[model samples]
Target: MYAGTAKFPVRKGKNYLLRIVNAAVYNHLFFMVASHNLTVVAVDTSYTKPYITDILVLSSGQIADVLLTANQAKAKYYMAAKVYTTHSEANIDNTTTTAILSYVGSKSSTTPILPEYNDTATVTNFREASDVAILQAYHFHIDDVYTTDFPSNPPIEYNYNGDVDKTLWVPISGTRVKVNEYNATVQVVFEGTNIFQADKPSNAYSRL
Candidate 1:
C-alpha cells in the first residue's frame, strides 16, 4: 500500500538536490531512488562530508539533503520509502509511499525496489511519540497525565538480542521524568529493547 504520489521532472545529465524528511511519528524508513545513487550532503540542517549511498535509513524527524544526478536512461523512476523494523514480531504497517522522478519528455515509469520489512542485515544503522504531551503534563504538574513509575532497570532480565519471551515484549506505559540539577552535565544512554514501539520514544529526535 502507498500514499500520495508526487512527481519531479528533471533533465538528463543535470544534478538536483532532494531534501528528504522522515516526518512519521513512529516509523523508521528506508528511502531510495530507482537505479540512482544519492550523495548525502547535509543532515539535520548541518553540512556533512559527501557520502554516496543507494539507500538511506531515516528515523523519525530526520532531515537529509542529497544530490541526485540524472544520468540514467531517459525514463521515469519511482522514488519510494518503506517501513523498516528490527524486531520480527513487531506489528507495523508494511507499506510503501512513492514519488516520481521523471526525466524530461519521458512518459514511462519504472517501479523502484524497496527493502524488505525485516531486512536487518541490510540496515546496519537506525520517532516521534507522545513526548510533547508528556512534557506539557510535567510542566503543569498534572499528575494524571502521566505516571512517574517508569522502570530504571528491566523488570525481568533475559537475552536481549536472542529469542525474547513474549511476556516481556510489551511493557507497562508511563511518563517517567528525571529532575536534574541546574548546569549539570548529563549523559543519556539509550538501550535498545528490541521492541519497535518501545524504542521509538528514545530515537524521536534523531539525525540520519
Candidate 2:
C-alpha cells in the first residue's frame, strides 16, 4: 500500500539495461514502468529472443534482463510492482510497491496503472507468448545432501475437489531432487491437499 522510495534516473532516447530479480519466497511479481515497454533479452543467465511487453511477471527467485528505453515524455512516472497470486483465498499481502522513473530535468509525475491482484489471464498470456530459455547445466554444491528420488506422480490419487481423507492430511518429507537430461521437457502438477469445511471455491494456475 505504500509507494516505494527507490528512483532511477534516465535520459531521453537512451536504452538502459535492467536486471530484475524476484527475491520473494512465495509470490510472483508483476513489474511495469508507467507508459513504457520493456524488451526482455535474457532470463536466469540464459539468453533468449527479445520479447517485448508492457508488463513482466517473474516467479519466485527468477531473474530477468530487460531493456528500458526512455522514449516517453520528459516527466516522472512510477514504476510499480505487485503480487500475482493464483488462489483467491490464499493469505497474501495485497500491496503495491513503487519506484520513480524520472526523466532528466523533469518534475511532474504520474502513477502507473496496474492489473488486479488475481489477474490470471494476463499472467498466463504473458508467459505463453514469450520464448523461455532452457537451462542445460546446473552447478550445485549439494549433490550428496539430497537424493534424486522424487516421485513423478502422487502416491494417492483421489477426487481433489470432493472427498476428505485423513491420510492425505500429512505430507511426506524428504530432501529429494529430480535431474533432467539436455533438451528434456518437464511437466509439474500441483495438487491441492487441503479440504475445506465450508463450500469455498478454489482455482489452479501454472506458468505454462
Structural similarity to truth (TM-score) of each candidate: 0.57, 0.61
Each prediction's whole-model lDDT (CA): 0.75, 0.78
Residue-level error in angstroms, candidate 2, position 188: 35
Model 1 whole-model lDDT (C-alpha atoms): 0.75
**Residue 163 C-alpha lDDT in model 1:** 66
As for candidate 2, its clashing pairs are: none
Q: How many backbone collisions does model 1 have?
A: 0
Question: Candidate 1 clashing pairs?
Answer: none
lDDT of 2 by residue, 66-120 (tens): 9999998999989889999877745888888888988999788878788888899
User: What does candidate 1's lDDT look like per residue over 127-187, in tens digits?
Assistant: 1111225667678775554566655565677765546678877765444655555666655
Error of 2 at 166 (Å): 71
